[model samples]
Target: MAQQFEDKFRRKFYYLRLSVTDVCNFKCTYCLPDGYKPSGSKNSSFLTLPEIHRVVNAFADCGTSKIRITGGEPTLRKDFTDIIRVIADNSNIQKIATTTNGYRMERGVAEWKEAGLTHINVSVDSLDPRMFHQITGENRFHQVMSGIDRAFEVGYKQVKVNVVLMKDRNHHELPLFLNWIKHRPIQLRFIELMQTGEMDDLFTKHHISGVTIRNQLIANGWILKVRENNDGPAQVFVHPDYQGEIGLIMPYEKNFCDSCNRLRVSALGKLHLCLFGEQGIELRDLMQEDAQEAELISRIQMQLQNKSVSHFLQEGNTGMTPHLASIGG
Candidate 1:
C-alpha cells in the first residue's frame, strides 16, 4: 500500500528526525543543567541498526524523503556513520543530515560526508571561549571551531550553526557572533530557548525573543536581504558584505505549526507527532509485537491521521520531561 502521511489538517509530512542515541557528552546548563540524569522511559531499549533501518524503510515507504539524525550527540553511537550509510543506500531517501554538538566532528566529518551526509547543524553557543565554556560546561571551544572548519574543508553543501540565545546568558553575543560569522560560509541560526516544563524557571530567566534580536541587527546596520526555505523553521537572511546567511528560529514569537511537515522518532522508538506533544505511540513495541510488516505499516499509517494539528507548547502548558537531550532537539 502506498500513501502520504497526512493528518486531518492535510499537513503532508516528508521529514523525519530520528534520534539515534539518548546519550550525550556535554552538559549544557539550559538543556541538561547540573547533576542532571534523564528520568528513564518505560521502554529504555535503544533501536538496533536493523531496527532503525526497518523504521527508516517504513517511513520511506510512506514518502519520507528527508531524514535528520539527532541525539544528545549523534557521534556517541558506534555506527553513526553506518547509520547514515544505510539511509543513503536507500534509493527513496533523498536528503540526509545531522544535528550534533561537534565534539568529535573534526575526526568524523570526512567519514560522515562520505556516508551521504549533505548538511550538518552544529550547536555553537558563542564565539567567546569563556562564554562557550559557561554555556556548554566544556572547555572544547577551539575544538568545536576546528570541527566546523573541517566540515567546510570537506565541502558540505550546508553547514548550519545553531545558537540558543538567552537573556542574561548569551543575548549579548548576537552582534559578536554575527561579526564572526560575517566572513565565514557557515549558516548561523539563533533558536529561541524552548520551555521544557522542568526547566521553566531557567526559561523564564533566559528566554529572548527573536524580534528583539532582529531589531538589534537592524539597529546595527545589518540588512536582511532574502528569505529562503519556506517550509523549514529558519528565517534566513544575508547581509550585503557577509559571506554567509543568518537564520532566526523564533518559535515563541512566530507560529510554524500550520506549515509544519515533519515527525520525530526518539532513540527508543517513540513516534513524536510534534515536539511538544507529551504522549507518543510506543513505535518500538508496536514493531516488535506486530509480526507482519504490512500490519506495522498499516498501523503507522492509521495513526498519522491522529497526529495533532498543533503542539500547544505555550509557556505554562509544558511539563513533559527527560529534557531536549532525550528528545533529540
Candidate 2:
C-alpha cells in the first residue's frame, strides 16, 4: 500500500466523503429553507463517472478503506448506482456507503444493494409526520418511513437515521426516537445543529449542545462504544436492553477534532481538508486524465499537512461554508 494518508497531527485518514452533487429536493429548514436554488453553473460541471473512479482509486491506493457518497441528496444524481459501482471496483475499499434522504430508497435500494452499497444513512429529522413536514418543507414523511422499512426488507442489517437536534423543534422527541429504535436495528444519530454563514439567526435560535443528551445516555446505562479507526465523528452508545444504538455528533465539544480521520471532496472536485476549512484545493485539473494519479496523490498528501489541529466552530468561524450541503456535511 502507498503511504497512509496522515495529517501533521498523525491522524491517519481511512475514510472519504465524496459529494456527487449539490442539488437537493427537500427544503430542510436548517439547510435550505427557501428550497435549492441552482448556482447558475452548468450541471455538466459536476464530476464525471471517470473522474469519480480516478479519485476513489487514488484514495484507495493511499490506504483509504471506506468511501461515503454524500450530497444535498446523493440520489438526485441519475448515475448514483454507477458511482457506487465505481467505488466498489476498488478492491482496497472495504466499505461503500451513501447518505440519502430516503425518497428513492423504497424503489431504488434493492438495486443499490445489488450494485454493492454496503451501508446507508437516511436523514429523518423528526418522527411526528406533521413536525417532519414542517421541518423538511415536504409532506413525504410516510414515504420516507416506508422507504426505511423497504431498506430492511432488502437486507440492510442496520440503517442509521440522522436527526439534527434543534431547540423547541425535535428536541422534545428524544424519548420518542429512543423508543422507536428500541426494538429496531437503527442507530439513531443526533447531530448538534451547526452554524453556517447563511444561517446565523437560525443557529442562535435552535442550536442545542449534544452534551445534555450524552449525559442522559450515561445516566440511563447506555455504554459508550469504542470507536473504530474508520468510524465517523459520532460517539456511538449501546444499551443492553435495546436492539438499536445511539450516536451523538457534538462538534462544539472540547477536543472534538482530536480524532479526525476523514477528508471530503466536493462534487466539483475540490478537496476540503476540513469541513470548515477556509478554502478547497482544486483537484479537477489533475483528475482529467488517468496518468495524473501520482500527482493527484501527492497533492492530496501535501494539502493534508496544512490541516489545522481543530475546527474554529467555537469561535464562530464557519470559514467559507455557507451551508452544510455545500461540502456534504
State TM-scores per candidate: 0.92, 0.98
Pick the TM-score winner: 2
At residue 107, candidate 1 shows an lDDT of: 95
Clashes of 1: 0
lDDT by residue (6-118, candidate 2, tens digit) is 99899999999999998899999999999887778564378899999999999999989999999989999999999999989999999899999899999999999999999
User: What are the per-model numbers of colliding residue pairs?
Assistant: 0, 0
| Pairs clashing within candidate 1 | none
> What lDDT tens digits, residue by residue, belong to model 1 across residues 275-305?
7776667778555532555665777778777
Q: In candidate 2, which residue ranges exceed 4 Å CA deviation?
A: 42-44
Mark the 10 consecutive residues where model 1 has the least summed lDDT. 223-232
Maximum-lDDT candidate: 2
